[model samples]
Structures are given as structure tokens and as C-alpha cells.
Target: MPAPPPHSPTSEEDIRWMRRALHLAEQGQGAVEPNPMVGCVIVRDGQPIAEGFHQRFGGPHAERDAVANVPAGVSLAGTTWYVTLEPCCHTGKTPPCTEAVLAARPARVVVAMRDPFPKVDGGGLQQIRAAGIDVQVGVCQEQAEDLNAPYLKRVRSGRPWVIAKWAMTLDGRIATATGNSQWISGEASRAEVHRLRGRCDAVIVGGGTAEADNPTLNARPPGPRTPTRIVVSASGRLAVDSNLVQTIDQGPVQLFASADAAGLQPLVDAGVEVIQFDSDSPSDRLAMVLDHCGAANMTNVLVEGGGDLLGGLFDLDAIDEYHVFIAPRIVGGAAAVSPLGGQGRNKISDSPVFATPQVSRCGDDVYVTARRVSESPPKSVSFNP
Candidate 1:
């Protein structure tokens, strides 16, 4: 099971300050992947003097940013520090955040939660305690965990958190008889999809969707980071003239295929990296792709594949979250494609149940998001950076 919120109930003032720090943490989204989004607030006399967030990967951490922002004349000797995550004790691209905190000489440190990274799991807290500074943990912890779900999952499970998304009609049809799926949702919903893509490390599609939609798969109104575009195919029949092949320079494109698949030379010649696996099973192939992603330290992966591909991931029980967009129009046809396709549940009771469903509106479309309910926490795994 996931660890319980550390420490006893904190004061309301602590919760309020931690909530503000979490909000600051959210500002680093779309820019800080592989690294957790963290925020820090330096408080003196119960009032915030300065605040900062982890702005980008391999740059200064939140603690350093906050400490640096403190006024030149103002001393940090007696101030209190509120941070969304525990400060780092190990150095990677930057120095240890514990060094900064020790140098700042804060009287007390309040953290929303502990860092799950193996190297810094409890090392950060230990360092501060050793320095004779008071540390209070677990204030607004659940909110902080939700904010950094992708990062936490990546560290604990050794794989990217997968988000399965689709846009369908009220009747649950993703496409008509002829597979013409243009404009299922309104303009606003499509824009929201672009924003979603901006936050993920990669966007994946099946060969069928790639062949049909010819999507550019780039985030519109461009985000801080460019997500890699991936196409999974068993036959390896991607067209060289397709938009993905033509725009290789705009963003990274990767093709995952089975060994001995046909017509791959054209794609390879077009500068697409072809990754081959021995397994032909959809579930097995998906596992290999996820392993590849995990090795690359990708924190969030968005799956926008067609019905069959989505069904395969569902069968494997690999998806962590679902984003469904429901349009008002009804496309009635027996041959139409629904959201999920392969080997559906045998009984209604056998279907997977989701938790904490959130519903909202995007113009004329209704957007729903929910996480897959799990009986136990993900098995802990080690991922060395």
C-alpha cells in the first residue's frame, strides 16, 4: 500500500501554506518531465517572503529557487520553509537541495510529502534533522501526490503512467461505417486534447489511426516541451508520404514493429526509427514498448490509438487513467467502431471500475476523466538515473 501521510494533523495555517505551494508546483507542468514538479515558499513571521517552483529539468530545484529569491537584506535564520516535496540530498545535474536549505538556516521545514526517489526517499529529511532544524511532513500530502502522480508512479513502478483517451458520440461510436471520424468533438475539446498532449512525454497511435487520420500529432499553441510521436504497427506498412514521415524534423517519430514485417524500408529511409520486437501478440508488444519508455525515464505517456489498440492495452490492464470526450451527435450504424474493441469483458460485473470520476464541459462536448481502481499499490521498483 502507499505510505500513509507522515506526521500528525498539522495546523490549518500549515495546510493553507502547503496548498499555495502545491499551486505553485503546478506552474512547472509541461516543462518538468522525468523530474517531479515541486514548489517552495519561504515564510517569515507567518507571511510569505518569496516563492519559486522547479522551472525546468536539470536546472535549479525549487528550494534553491526560493532561497535565492529571498531579499538581500532579509535573513533566513528564523524563517520557515514550506515545500511540496522533500528537498533532494543527492546531486544529479545540479547540487543537492539539502545544501541550500542548510545554508539558508531555516528554523523549521514543512514538506507536503517525502520524495519517492530511491536515493532521496528519506535522506533529505534525515539531513535536515541532523542539522538541528525542525521538519514537519505530510501537510496537504494527498493534494501534492495527485499533483505529481506521474512522477511518483514513474519512480515506484519503473514505467510511465499511461493515459487512454478517445472522443466518441453519445452512442459511443468513435467512427461511422466508413471510418470517417472527423470532428467528433467540438473545437474546444480538440484544443483541450492539444493541451493534454503538451503535458505528456509521448503520444502514441496504432497503425490504423496513423494511416487514416494522417495526424501531425504535435501540440497546438505549443507547450514548453515537445512530445515524441510514436506509431505501433505489426505489418510495418506506414506510408512514406504520410504527415508523420514528412515532418520528422519538427518532432521525434518512432515506429514499433514486429520482426520480418513488410514495407519498412521506405519509413526507415524517411528517418523514422524502427524498433522491432519478437512477439506478435498485441499485449506482449505493448509491454515491450512500455519497457522501452521506462528505460528512457518517460514519466507520462498518452495513448490516442484506435479501438483495437485501446482494447489491447485494456486487456493488459496497463492504462492508469481514462479521458473520454462525449459529443452530442449520434452516428447510428451497425458497422461503426466503438471506443474499445478487442476481447471485451465477458460480463458486466467483469468490467473494470474507475475511481474519482471528474466530469466537465468543453464547449458542446462533455469531458470525463477517471483513474483505474487498483486493489493494491504498484510494486516498488528501482530506477537509477
Candidate 2:
């Protein structure tokens, strides 16, 4: 039929447009849960031409949309396309993006890296080159993978994304021996704390935790809306008349525990979803709860805990990440609870929590965010009530 179309990035503006395409991909964050948000920029002869990003599951994927959106009649020869993830080859919700790329018939294809999947893995790359197109890999490999980790993680393990948040003293104490913790973090840090909660699908805490702390696990953001509040009470004995458990008409409250059926029955009667499991392991229970919520794209759980729960999750290696806020004011009580050091289980290794990098900030408080260093001893919360 017609000679497809011409495509080439022939100007500095063209290259800038390509960069903007990648930036557009960032918008998928928060919006593209359970799936990694990805951006793509197609250029011909180093000029900005077309752009796209993976917005939602049923929506058009980044590379495919970008290629298809290009205006007709542009010379397809001698143009280069930059995409975050390798264009997907197999069609699921949308058609194979590789086919779209080949149809465009650009001079060169520059992708972040080969796809790490099996079904559609690297098939796009092969298909394009098979059609006589030049392909370059690893333009920004790390960033691409980082941007797509949520989708990759789900694709690999059918599990939801997870992150842990806690406030510890300078000396690493989570609570005092007396068990009085009115305010652990300052205002700025607390504001940031709620922000993390607002982003998660659920917020989790312990039963003994809810009882002792009487926490309002609701992730109240600056505005009225907040994430669902979840309490991990294995005993399932939260005070029916208690303030925290009493329905505020705010949002739904949940409890995960193994308490006496009678004690929990009342809450169930009050319209609470009680996830009664055979055991009392937070990590195990959490995985099930997250799955039940339909972790298709990306969902996160922000855990704000006291010492026992924090240590438990670490011992189990269930914690995917840790974002700790440390107020500089020294509350060096001899028996202060720690973000990680308090007691559930101990490790023989000098530092059991093998870590990647610990980023610390002390604007109003010294905040430390760390990723689980290694999987070898990746232990998770081991509290059995």
C-alpha cells in the first residue's frame, strides 16, 4: 500500500522531546500500582517526535502507543527510539509492542535492556532485529529496572510491593521501658509519615500493639482521605468499646489474628473484616491479605511499629524496605525500644540485616531508609500470639 511513514530526529528539540517522553513515564507512579510505570520516547534522526508511557493495564502501553501515534509521511529510515523497558513482544492486554516498533521501521532502536520476563522476554528485541532493524541495549539499564521493579516483582512472585516505616531514637530505641510513647517523631517527620501511609493500600500494626498503643492506624493525609487501617492482632481481642476499634465512620478497619472466636465475633458483628488464620505470623498473614486485595498492578503496605513488631519482621526478613525517622534529641533511656535492635530474635552475623545502602537525613530528624541487603538471611516478623 502506502510507504508507511518517514521518521527521524533531526534537531536538538527532537532529542529533548525524547527526554520528555521518558519524564512522562514517571506520571505512572502511584497511578500504576501493581504494574511498573514506564515511559517511552521515539525519535527520528535525533529529534523529538512521539512519546508515551504505560498508564494502566487495559490502556495502551508506552512503546506501542508512542510508535502508533507518530504522524504519517515522515521518513521512517534513520530514526532512533528510546524506550524505558524493552518493548513487550507477546500480547496480553495490548498487542505486542515490538511489532509496532518494526512497522515504524526506524533506523535504530535504543532500549534500556532486554526484558527480564519469560513469555515476552527479549522476544521484542529479536523480532525487531529479525525485521532488519538496528537495536542498542542498556542505554539506562538501572533506571529502567528501578522504574519497572513493581511490575517485575509481581511477574516473578505474585506478591504485592511492601515497605516499612518506623520512628526510632538516636540511640535506636523504639520505646521506653515504661511503654509510654505519645509522640515518637516531630511534626515534619510525622507529616512525612502520614504521606507514606496515604500512598499504601493498607497500614498494618499488631494486636497487642493496637491494645497497648491505642493507635489510630488511619493514614490521615493533609486532606480528608486516608488509606485503609489494618490491625494485625493475632489474639483478635481489640476492645470493642475502645476508641481505636470503635468505628469512626472514617474508613474500614481490619484485624488479622487468632483470638477466641467469641472475642472476635463481636467485631465481626460490627462489620469488621476479621482475617482469622491458623497461625500468628505477621509476614505470612500480610502476604495473604495483600493477595486477597487483588495485587494486580502495585500495592504497598506501610508498617509503623514499636520494637517487638519491628524486630519480628526483620527476623523474618519479611521487611522489603525500612524508612526510619530519627529525632536528634537523645532519648537514651537504658531500655528504649529500637527500630531493629529490641528482642524478638537475634542474629549470629555481626550485622544480620545485610543492606544495600543506608540513606540518612536529619532535617528535623535523622531519617534512614534502607533496602534489605541480602536474601540469604532474609528473615520476617515471627510473632505468634
Candidate 1 deviation (Cα RMSD) = 5.1
- CA lDDT, every model vs. true structure: 0.88, 0.65
lDDT of 2 by residue, 206-241 (tens): 666678778776655532234567776666757777
Q: Report the lDDT of model 1 for residue 271.
A: 94
Q: Write the per-residue lDDT of candidate 1 for residues 1-385, one digit (tens) a residue.
A: 2232334346777777888889999999878889999999999887999999999998889999887788888888878899999999997999999999999888889998899899999999988888778888777776787788888888988889999999999999999999999989999999999999988889999999999999988898787778889999988857899999899997889999988998898888889999998786778899999889888889989999799889998888888899999999999999998988888888999888877799999999999999976666433322111
- TM-scores, all candidates, are 0.93, 0.77
Looking at model 1, residue 104 earns an lDDT score of 88
Local error of candidate 1 at residue 96 (angstroms): 0.5
The C-alpha RMSD of each candidate to the native structure, in angstroms, is 5.1, 7.4
Residue runs of model 1 more than 4 Å from their true location after superposition: 1-9, 377-385
